[model samples]
Structure formats: C-alpha cells, structure tokens
Target: MKKSAAYWIWTICLAPLIFLAVVWQKLPGRVPMHYNINGEADRYGSKNELLVLIGILFAVNIGTYLLLSNIHRIDPKKKYTAENLPVMKRFAFIITFFMTALSCFIIHTTLHAGSGFNGKFVVALIGLMIAALGNYMYNIKPNYFAGFRLPWTLESEENWKYTHRLAGRIWFVGGLVLTVLAFFLSEKAGFNVLMIITAIIVVVPTVYSYRFYKQNLNK
Candidate 1:
C-alpha cells in the first residue's frame, strides 16, 4: 500500500476503537430507531459481539481502501483527484464513517438495552450523510456514472462542466456544514435541516443549469 493509503487504512481501523472504547460498556442493549426502511435490525449479538463486528467493518473498510490504492499504483497514470472524481474517493470514506455510526446506532437500539430513541431524529442523521454523499458524487464527475447525470449534463459537455463547477462548491460546503452539525444537532432537528438542505441542493442547480443551458443553446 502507498504510504498515504496505508496511513488512512490504519486510521480507519483505530477510529472506532478510540471513539467508542470508552463508551462501549455504556451502549444500550437495545437501540430502537423508529424508521425501519429495510426492516433489517442489526440485532445479532452480545455487546462483545457487536464490538467485534464494528472492528470487522473497520478492517473491511481499510482493506477496500488498500485495494483501490493498489489499483491506482498499478496504473500510476490514473489519478483519483478532484478533477477526475471531484474528491469523491476521499468523501466516500467520510460517508462510510457516518454509515458505520448509524449502523451501530441501529444495533444499539435493536439489542434492547437502554435509552429511548427519536426515530425521526436518527433518520435525519442518516439523511444528512446521504445527502452529503450525493452532493460529493455530483461534484466528482460530470459523467453519468458519478453525479446527478441530468439530461442536459449528459447531453452537452459544456452543460456538464457548468453544472459541476457550481454543484461542486455548493455540495462541498453544504456537506461540511451538515457533517459538523451531525456532531451537534439533536436527531429530529438535525434531520429537518438536512432534508431542507438536500432539497435545495438538488433542486436549485438542476433548475438553474437546465435554464442556463437552454439560454446558451438558443444564443
């Protein structure tokens, strides 16, 4: 593994260990998140088992990063930077971090330990992370494989360029704010903020870009 990737891999491994170790014993036996979209509860083990599973997720994340890094190394010509992916690979790790925490929350509730959960609130947290992920993906590439992939964006390179230029800044800043808030806001209020922010990010650029492209096309 390249030194950079190796460092991140190790960093991921230790992230949960350091953050949750102190509170590992304090984790509620059952964490009840009201919204069960998939109806899948992560209630399959003792607290000890749950901690092990978290470790496994951490390990898997590092391994995946390693593999991708190797791919980059093999094809040194291939660069995974903001221009190519708009900082997507880097943002992906952040998304994964939030997702892991969300999953742990689910497990914490399902195990039926202590503390009542605010379902809407927890759902909002997940939504914020998801919105951030979507924003990053859109910024990463104008290609269909990455971002919003609107008809205009896909149809015209110019449109793609313009849309991403605007989208990148919007999403990056929006995501940063949301991520920070994720640390501070209560579940319900936090999610409400995330939902509103997500809608604005999606709707504004899409409408603006389409109109902008049309005007240019006519001109």
Candidate 2:
C-alpha cells in the first residue's frame, strides 16, 4: 500500500514537468518570469526560465517526498508506528499536490503574460496549505524531521504534546485569517499579515516549549 502511495506521490511531483512539456511550444520567446507586489509582470525572460523554475520545483518536491517517506528510518528515536506511516504519507501527498498546483499556476501566468497573476490567489493557496498542515500537526508524533522539534520538545514528550496542540490551534486560526485577508486586503497588506502571523505561530510555540521545560526543571 505504501509503495502504491509512493508511486502516486512521484507521479504528482512530476506532473508540473509533464505539463510544461506539453505547453512548451506555445510559450513566447519572452515571458513574464517575475511579478511585483501589485501582481504586475515586472521581469521578462526566455521561456527556458520557466523550464528552469519547473525543474527546480520538481527537484525540491521529490527531495521532500523522499525525506518524509524515509524520515522514520533516519530518526534516532524511531517513534513512528504503523498508524503514523499513513499520516506522514498523506501529508507528503498534500505538499506534493500544493507544489504541483503552484507550478501549474506559474506556467499559466507565464503563458498569459500580461493577464496579471493574482497575488491574492497565491496567498490564499499558501494559507490553505498551512491550515491543512495545522489540521494534521496535532496528530503528528515526535519525529526529528517534522513539527516543533525543539530541543526542549524533543527531550520531553509532555512538552512535545502540549506545544504541538497549542501550535496547531495557532496555525489553523492564523491560516484562516490569512486566507480571509487575501480576499479583502491589498496584496502588500495580505503579505504583511502573513509574515506577522507566521512569526506568531513559530515564536509562540518555541517560547511555550521553553517555558514548559524551565517549569519542569523547577518542579
């Protein structure tokens, strides 16, 4: 079953490259390769630039899938279980799906050139991805590769459990807000909110984990 899942995961990771190949001939000599905060195409480059970008994304996608798939083997703690395996694979597929969609979005943007990429749409996509991950974060077991994995959290299962629970809530709510802001705010404003919220989600958990560690020491 896991091998079948791996095959599907790799197929999804390769989808963007396949898509690019099909549309390669249709792309113009110069295409919009970069967009400004306002979502206007500001940099033009050869269609080969898109090819390079797709190649890089594909490499990253495959590398991430491999790492997640084998994370249990590499972890010294080896805290994974038969149940945890499916969850990890599902998360890997979610990430693969997001990257594939992102690559397709970029290709569509390049193909349409001046149609103007929707920055808000990308923002919302990221938000959705974060929210989806957060939804699973609570169930994540202690692995060296994923989650808060702080020194303090990894040392103590209690810290890992409580910190992840808190972080999961923070991320889910923050992600939802970011998604809503993408619809209502300017691109720049939406990005600003995303940065602030991302910091909050990361910092809050780190601080909480450390505090939990200190308090336990005092006890």
Candidate 3:
C-alpha cells in the first residue's frame, strides 16, 4: 500500500470534488448537467446528479492510476523500467490534472448558470492537453497500455520511436492551431473544425506508422 507520487497527485485532483460535496446542499435544485457547443445548457438534472458524475470521475482517475502503476503486473510483455517510471508518473499527473479541471468546470457551470463555459474553451483546453502530451510522447518507452499503440509501432521499437517523434510534431502543431482557432471561430464552427483537426491528428500518425513499418519491411 505504499502510494506513489501519482497517488498524491490524484488526491490533490480529487480535493475540489470533496469541497463541492461539502457545499452540495446550498447548490440550486435544478442544475445544468450538459451543455451544447453554443455554450447553452441543453440538459438539466438535479444537483444531486453532480455527485454521481463526480463519483464516476473519481473512479475513472483512480482506476486508471492503479492500472498504469501496476501495468507490469497485468501485461507480461510490458515491464516498467527505471527509465520509464518518471515518464509514466508524468503521464498520470497530466491525466489527473485534466480530469480535475473538467470536474471543476462542470461544478462551476452548475453553480453559476451563466458561467459561460463553451465548446470553444473546452476544445482549447483539449488542444493544450494534446500539446502537452505531444511534448512527452517521444520520451515514452514502448508500452502496451499507452502511447500510439498501432500494431506496427507496438511490434518494432524503431517504429514506435519514429512514429512518436513524427506524431509529437503533428500533435503539437495541430493542437496549437486548434487552440488559436477556438478563439476566432464561432462556437459551432469551432466544434466542426476541432473535429477535423482531431481526425487529422489521429489519422496521420497511424498512417505514417504503418507506412514506416512497411518501408522497414521492404528493406
């Protein structure tokens, strides 16, 4: 039961949910549970539903942390090396932080109906997260549970490194562009554009990985 640094990080991330729970009775009875791309709350539910959402979020983050921390125990092919430990810890921190932000945003939007949470901002935050991940993707050692897990990449360490390096550049640039676009475009238009950019970000790397593998095979 010796907790790792990631456990501490997750605890910090969960703090806001605990705070919200303490103040739950004071919140409005009918709260906005879901919002559309236009920044309007299209769905409504009891404030108590927030508790369910928070519980699910907490479970997901903790479960992911445990699975990742003990990946070696589950996957025989993927053992955690000393060199990869820091990278894995950093990845866990990133996921926890992003979840924390999202949980807080949901709570805030519920508490303050006019809080102006919109798709553009959410997309921008996603962009920022993608960029951050891209920055570290190249540092990640080959693992079954993480990184660009295309068959080609997983099969060859060379393919994994090369694909990640290329993917890192694509995601960083794509993410930056998406973040900027989120500010200038209309909410609906921004969401459409975000989808396109995301598709490109995902598809390009996968195709490249396969091609790279094929090239190596031909050699």
User: Which regions in candidate 1 have their CA more than 4 angstroms from the true location?
Assistant: 1-7, 10-86, 104-113, 118-139, 176-186
**Ten consecutive residues with minimal summed lDDT in candidate 3?**
74-83
Alpha-carbon RMSD of each model: 6.1, 1.6, 2.4
Candidate 2 residue 34 C-alpha distance from true site, Å: 1.5
Each candidate structure's TM-score, on Cα atoms with residue i matched to residue i, is 0.57, 0.93, 0.89
Best by TM-score: 2
Ranking by TM-score: 2, 3, 1
- In candidate 2, which residue ranges exceed 4 Å CA deviation? 81-83
Relative to the true structure, candidate 1 has a C-alpha RMSD (angstroms) of 6.1
User: Model 1 misses residue 163 by how many Å?
Assistant: 1.3
Decide which is better by TM-score, 2 or 3: 2
lDDT of 2 by residue, 84-167 (tens): 566676678778888999999998888787688888888898888888888888888777778998998888889999999999
Name the candidate that leads on lDDT. 2
Candidate 3 per-residue lDDT, tens place, 1-219, comes to: 346764677576687688687678778888888777678888888876888888898788777766666665555455446556667666777777777777777777677787756677777888887887787888877777778888888789899988889888988888898899988999898889888988998899899999999889999
lDDT of 1 at 76: 35
Q: What's the lDDT for candidate 1?
A: 0.60
lDDT of 3 at 27: 85
Which stretches of candidate 3 lie above 4 Å from their native place?
Answer: 1-7, 78-80
